[model samples]
Target: MVDVFFNTWDNNRINNSRPIDTNDPTYVIVHGYQSTGGNPGNNFTPQAWMSEMAQNIRDLEGNDANILVVDWQDGANTLNYFAAADRVDEVGVEVADYLLGQGVNPANTTLIGHSLGAHIMGEAGEELRERRGEVDRLIGLDPAGPEFEGGWFSRPNSTDYRLDPSDADRVVAFHTSSTLGYDDPLADLDLYINWDDLLQPGASTFVGNHGYAHTLYNDLLDGFGFAQSNGTTLSLSTINGNTAGSVFVDTFTV
Candidate 1:
């Protein structure tokens, strides 16, 4: 099961009963594999980034927006990657039901997920579309590639199996690590940061590289600025249209 935590504009964690205002935008953040949600920290160092990103959205949207953090640590923190991957769709349904019960408007909601959580959000968005049509935006922060893209498991070519353009009205993704993260263009607008190599600059390991997507995204939420890619200026603040292609961001030059 997935646990969805709510946050007020004051950044205070609240219970699920607080009615969400459908007029304002809501941001839901989901963490990836082998991680728990909270502040102190977890074995996965970047797990805490969820709270930071949620708070950043809270600060950006003020009292008008709703910020949600999803905890699927029970399903995620496991030695068997395949077992954990199998739980994505189940968790996604749980999340989608929670939002539906809360009366969250899909047109005013954005689902953001990292690694395996990205695919989970994809399933959630798909569930919402099946019931309510579509969501406003869906952002995948370095979606997991191992099983979803084809490895020791059966690779699914359908959008139903992973994050894709049909998941939301506007699907966007950021790729920072090609080794652990999905490198293919799955979103309507795919942004590849430091695409030339597997390891991102300043990242000593693949894990660190995988983390850059959320960290950089958190910064982008706080107006860290934009980058020029494929002759197009890209940033979170200016996401628009069905841009069906990949944009490479050379972090060193940007």
Candidate 2:
């Protein structure tokens, strides 16, 4: 079943609208590491991130498009990477099954993930593709963590075995400040967006570090726009409010 964690405002407003309708595609957002509960270092509580993302999606797509923010109990632990990835796949299947039960077409659903969450999305897409058809879309936002560069981390290319070009009609991958080479494995995909080469003259060159400025968030918003417009790949500077960087978009038809 699709488990929905709505914002408190939505809960209190008590609208007559159904949280998710099968006729319309829904978005399931998965957050990155330290996004869960119980820590001062955490940017926002998992519930809060869910609420915020749901609100954003509602603002962009209105009430008809459903948004589900997932939370697993072990979301905060560092050693639970494998478990978390597995959970993402399980949750994806659950969401798809729920949508099917509600009469929603599998082709209409989309999965969006950031950082480690993106790896989770990849894993989920693979699992879902095995049972059902591919998901409508999978958006990866700067999807690499510390482990991704090292031998210990499970690379998306190696771990997510189902993101082949033949599986999905569209697969869009975006890299803002990814330390890993983002273009190699995905060059054959339908679309690839990158901004790593656009780093400012004096920008930090820390190895395996790409979390500079607010590039991550801006790239995500722009990526959403690009996906919706079916526009050509972009190579523009000035994303959000950051300067001295550029964005690139490339599309290939399979």
Candidate 3:
């Protein structure tokens, strides 16, 4: 486990503190392979990024749950995408093993994985399901698509290699980077924020839009009461630019 890093909100470094709290809900966050763990202007180290997200999630849970960050940076740093992708499976199994060893129930866990990490969580969830029979929920934040999507264009190891609806009881996904991300409806709730043009204000590249999934989810955690389309599906182009409050399908009501 030397190469893997797991942190929680109550105890930022779980390795140094008490066992994970099985009584409270658990959140596991996995970052993608395309990260420096550091961002410009923000200077966000991977740990720093997870810490902030943990705090936000804590707020969402009214400061009563466990937020864990699953980091596999050593393997993720590989130059070859295939090599990096192969490493996640072991990590997923290890993460699942740790939770079960800690006596944490999978039904109380919420796995949130981003990009490549999303698929990693799927693997972890699958591992848990195989042994424990089920996992609670999985949220894929713009799962990686380039080399993972199964189709005639590129051969995939398995469609289930990435996040899929079968991994957990509930799967919610936001396809912010449709062009470079999984285009299929892989989540129980597949959300597409502004599917057309794929022009995100932050940048012209796919990453600009990819990063916003975290931002939007963070906002939901922060109690922004993000609205879901009403009955009809939404076609939002820019999260901020759009003011069609009428399209709100649902919101975490206060």
Candidate 4:
């Protein structure tokens, strides 16, 4: 059975206003870590962000795509790396089952994750590929955390199914960060789309330290088959003493 957190036409108020088709491709966005006091940092809420993305897609695509926001409170706390990793796979399966139930072909769905959310998407995508043979695309938006690095929370490259050399057609990762260690893992991805090449000239600092911005979200919206054109690609510079070795934007057509 699939666990569904939200449906667009479920409520009479929303359904009566606009009847949405459930057959559209679904996009799931997962959020990253919270701050020290167990509060959602930077006012970042997974559901809110997902809703915004959904609205943007509908406005741009004219198709009512289902956008699901996954929230795992237990995984948010510190020192629970194993549990967090497990939750990612669980959420992925749940989302996949939900999409299947809605009559949306698994091949049409896309999963997008940011920061630790990227790790979740990786695990989830692997599970979906192995079990359901669904989930056509998995986009990693600056997937950074202790798990990607060498630590007790580390997730080895072997666990990232999307990075497999043989399955090159389905996976794409975008790295956009001025901070070195934050976006270094993007280098190992199969199809890497660097934001350093996608930003407009003189548009240096992105809004948050590690959160979605207009530029990043616009790129995602465009990539997911909504908008015709998104943001620009700017040149990235390499700073010394950082984990990022070289920064360049290259598109992979598969």
The C-alpha TM-scores of every prediction are: 0.88, 0.59, 0.80, 0.59
Instruction: Compose the digit string of candidate 1's lDDT tens values, residues 94-208.
Output: 8888889878898889999999989999999999999986999999999998788875656654678889989999999889988888878999888888788757767899999
lDDT of 3 at 43: 32
Overlapping backbone residue pairs in candidate 4 total 7
lDDT of 3 at 174: 74
Model 3 quality (TM-score)? 0.80
Candidate 3 Cα RMSD (Å): 6.3
Across residues 45-154, which tens digit of lDDT does each residue of candidate 3 receive?
46455566777776567656877766677778777877787776787888888888877788888888888888889888988888885778787888888678866876
lDDT of 4: 0.47
Q: How well does candidate 4 match the true structure in TM-score terms?
A: 0.59
State in Å the error of residue 201, model 2. 12
- Deviation of model 1 at 163, angstroms: 0.8
Show how many residue pairs clash in every candidate, following the order shown. 0, 2, 5, 7
Clashes of 1: 0
lDDT of each: 0.79, 0.47, 0.68, 0.47
Model 2 TM-score is 0.59
Off by over 4 Å in 1: 1-19, 39-46, 229-232, 238-243
lDDT for model 3, on a 0 to 1 scale?
A: 0.68
Q: lDDT at 95 for candidate 1?
A: 83
Which candidate, 1 or 4, has the higher TM-score? 1
Candidate 4 per-residue lDDT over residues 1-254, each given as its tens digit: 21224234222112223433556766666655541111234222334554555566566545556555555544555576545544555655565555555565556666666656666666666655665565666656556544444555555445452223222125555555434124444433422234545333234445253443324554445553221133423221111012232334433211
The candidate that achieves the highest TM-score relative to the unseen native structure: 1
